[model samples]
Target: MTTSHETSLPTCELGPGGPIVSRLALGTMTFGVETDESVARRQLDEFVEAGGTFVDTADVYGDGASEEIIGRWAAARGGVDDLIVATKGRFAPPAGSHGASRRSIHRSVDRSLRRLGLDAIDVYFVHGWDDFTPIEETLDALTSLVRAGKIHHIAWSNVTGWQLQRIITTATLGDFVPPVAVQPQYNLIDRGIELEVLPCCLEAGLGIAPWSPLGGGWLTGKYDRGQRPTGNTRLGDDPERGVEAYDVRNTERTWRILDEVMSIADEHSRSPGHVAIAWLLSRPGVASVLLGARTAEQLNDNLAAADLVLSDAELGRLTSVSATHLPPYPYGMIEDFCDVDVWKRLGTASSA
Candidate 1:
């Protein structure tokens, strides 16, 4: 496997737009919530200097404060044309919204544009699928935006395989602009997407941009088995976000796997976070991994993953320890049919 560090950071075109972006995108979920304006500005400057053009934010992130911060940085930097900004809607304030209704979609994009200080968004995503609203209506609204120049491309986040497929089918039939990318929760510990969401993206020709690539800092080996992180840690400060990280089953397994990751990092003289991010970049269909950092030191360490390449032997060992079990039925059946040996020997040699 080729490490991102061994060569220049990869670039991919955003949908049909001409703007090119680095393979590693900076996520701004913690921009305003965990990090203040000064720290956020420093991180943004470092990222731009590192050749990272892709910036991901959401309308609901810190109630739009994240987008505002990013907008300020972009304006101050005076290179808005060179950046590929991607922000999501449908997760706006007042909390617990169902789906992307026409009114909500319009309002959300207008608010996002105001917060971003831009005339249009480079790429926009439906934060999550809405079961209550008709999928066609949502696609129609998004397509209208594309036609009106409000957004350049459409994308999806936190959607299931079936939902993604349905949206694609609707767009194709309606001649709407199909989604060009997907954002999902994917990492060593959260491999559920491998069974469905990933395959759907591959089949549809949509790029995969995974969020929480470090498993919300779990893969960095920061939290102990029984010790809870407090204060600044996302898990400690946010009760709602902490539940997933604090799961007993997941905590035990994450620590166990961290032992293996630590060994690999030690061999390469890198931090565990670097190794963890590298492992995600090694996976198939991973166009980029979204990483969030509160401090410049943390950001620098995470950025080094762009240069850290794991040898084939190291990748194999990490895979063995971190691979999760597939549930019975179609998934198990598919795994049995598409064995690893057959995959490497006869399957298509595409970058995962």
Candidate 2:
């Protein structure tokens, strides 16, 4: 593994005809919580200077303080139109009605706009599928919002592949405002979405804005192998995190993944987290990677990945080492069915 690498960030369309945004996005989940407003502002400034244009936040984050900070910053920076502001709805908590109903969405969007001081949002996410609210009702509400100029585009997070396909199909058939993107947990360790969500997005023209590109700081190499996580780190501070993470991720599989990442990091002379982020940026269907940090230093360090375009060999090396195959059944059978003999037999039979 070699450690020397350099890459540059660039803008791409969020989806088909959607807004063009930076390859890397800033996630403000820690604002007003682990990171105070002052430090959060500094992090935002540094990120924008480093070519980041997409900023993501949820209404539930920091009890709306995150959006407030973003609003204040946008006010000073000459309004929200300059940046591609993305915010989420749903999960109202104490207010109840935690679904994408007409009432829920209207309330969420109004509150988000008030907090962010914006009239229209760039990408408005549903946060998650609201089973409590009929999908049709949710779609209708989103379409109304678009027509009313309240939201520029609609998006969804934490949804399944079938669910997303249905939503896109229904929207298109009804001429409603279609969802242009999806935000799912994606990283070296969490590839479950690759099975369905990634494929659906590829065909449906939905952009993939992957969250947890750092795997909750696991890919940062802060946790040592075979040792209890110690110190003030995210997982170190919470002992239960290790037990939960180690349940499926603590095996030769992860060790190999970490080892290869460290090797690549050494070759590039960057942090393992940087290498991880670079690998994710190269993945298909990834419009932007959501990078979050508790401090400006972490944000700067993660931003280094923007310029790293992994070599073919490096890409192959990481893919082979870190890839996890899905269990037997549909995925296994589908791959196994693709064979020279089977292809010839099927072709002959069809021709006959």
Candidate 3:
């Protein structure tokens, strides 16, 4: 049995030996947007009191208001010296420039430092891949930040397999500070990253901090089939909102996966979300799973998953049911004639 405030969750290194963070990281994307400061502060306090140490946020979240909220929280608590604070800076670039350009990155880092009330960011992530800027240019700017002590470790998010490989190649050749981690959206309903991105990260020895592990609330079992959400839910407010829109995710496959998750939850007497998150934690190369919530209660509910380890049979069932078919071109071709077991390499079913 666990105490009220003690999560008793394990820890993992972000990179091989980079900053050690709690297995479940608190994501502050809802700060100052869906949630006010007081609630946000409560969530942060709850997270830390429950043994969470990594807090992730981005400069564009709430148009920098999220960082400001976190900054105030840290100020009230004296400082986040014990926490591994991470923030991204590839969304809001300077005027007339791309987000990943040298000028934009330099400006973004300074602003993030000021907003977070920290001398140096613990883990600074480039929010996404920027085609407009060369990978070398971005790597150079990040290397300079490391030297100046403005940032400690570097990471990337929302990149493809080719892009990530290129970044690693460029940084290795140029002697730049390589990324310690890569953040991608990985969940049962969205296992697209397993195709190439996951393999690349595993090979490069980069930690994967996965976002949207609950498939934007689909894996939570809160939404029903054939019924449109109509409340204060993420889809209710705007069914056609972002990637997790109602219509987009309301498919047969989604319901099948959700049913399996609910079955596992019932067996464990836990929330469906607990099953979803537990499954992610069982995967390889998963350093931390980012948990985003709109309220303290939601965050607390998510924290319970730390203690819920799924059985091998249950995990295999979920993985099998949610497995996607691989494309026909290269992945399928290689598996067919080359005697190379792509399915074993992927650790999942070949079908996408």
Candidate 4:
């Protein structure tokens, strides 16, 4: 169901028969962490007020406080009947059990439902590929949830090209429910998925909802070059927190990308983050971009990216500046032989 009030942002189907969601999704990863319940509620209200209908969270986020906060917000507002709510599991499993096991998934989904105050989840994602469990076991468990009306659709996150393909193939062969989408870390700074994960999604008709679209605040133009962060920002608190660690991404290439992004933002009179998001939306398979904001103010600023459209030339320039290098062995050789252009089409082909 769509939101009661029409949204200002454009919408699209997440995949074939998937939910029609806003181009920007509200990510509640910081709901119970940096953001208190009152601030989190304001964020939710403002997100819905701006016409956002998709909300993404995870069980491991704040040890399930994120989902609980969202649940309370929904309860206060009557319900989330008009929104498409998605959450992930497979990160915090049951005692002594590995993630993605049948028992683990079953328990995770039930607890998620209880926390989210929903009879059924709109989309359920497996947080990452679990090496200890067979893909078949995971699919079987998700299929059971779908059959029991616990989840409407299934998706996978943080999988490689081969892992994603294997999930789809196993679901098809085993006659289980196929995934409608795949979530990956995609942005101007990290087009690593363009090599394989993206091509597989495009071929398999799976929609892509990219997390960390701002490259964990690197693309926000807040951090300075050569100077270590020292404020209240994500990196300021912990520079080596995750994938966008300052030392890892403070290279010449990242600076170049930021320079281009800043230039484009000045051209459009928008924030560097908006330019970064608009560029991601222009990519082939992105159904929505997740905004991981800690406050309503930040979310409002990020949501404004929905209206910032870059021209083809501007898009090309950003793409050129941040292109990822394709590997040599099979990818480069195959493209050379079969007249099959892979990353080239994505504007991600660099010197191999």
* TM-scores vs. true structure, each candidate: 0.89, 0.91, 0.96, 0.97
- Where does model 4 exceed 4 Å of error? 1-5
Q: What is the Cα-based lDDT of residue 203 in candidate 3?
A: 86
lDDT-better candidate, 1 vs 4: 4
Q: Of the candidates shown, which would achieve the greatest lDDT relative to the real structure?
A: 4
- Model 2: per-residue lDDT, tens digit, 1-352? 1112132457778877777788889999999888998999999989888877899999989989999999998888888565799999888733656568898898889899999999999899989887777788899998999899999999999999899998988888888889888999988877768667877888787888999898888789887778767677766666566323644466777788888999999999989998999989888778899999999999999998877778988977887776656445565565466532322211111110
Lowest lDDT block of 10, candidate 1: 342-351
- Which regions in candidate 1 have their CA more than 4 angstroms from the true location? 1-8, 14-19, 93-98, 238-243, 248-251, 334-352
Predict model 2's lDDT versus the native.
0.82
Candidate 1 on 38-89: residue-level lDDT in tens?
9999988888778787889999888889999988887887748877899998
> Candidate 4 on 66-173: residue-level lDDT in tens?
999999999999999999999999989999888999999999999999999999999999999999999999999999999999999999999999999999999999
Instruction: List per-candidate RMSD values in Å.
Output: 4.1, 5.9, 2.7, 1.8
Model 3 pairs in collision: 324-351, 324-352, 325-351, 325-352, 326-351, 326-352
Number of clashes in every candidate structure? 4, 11, 6, 0
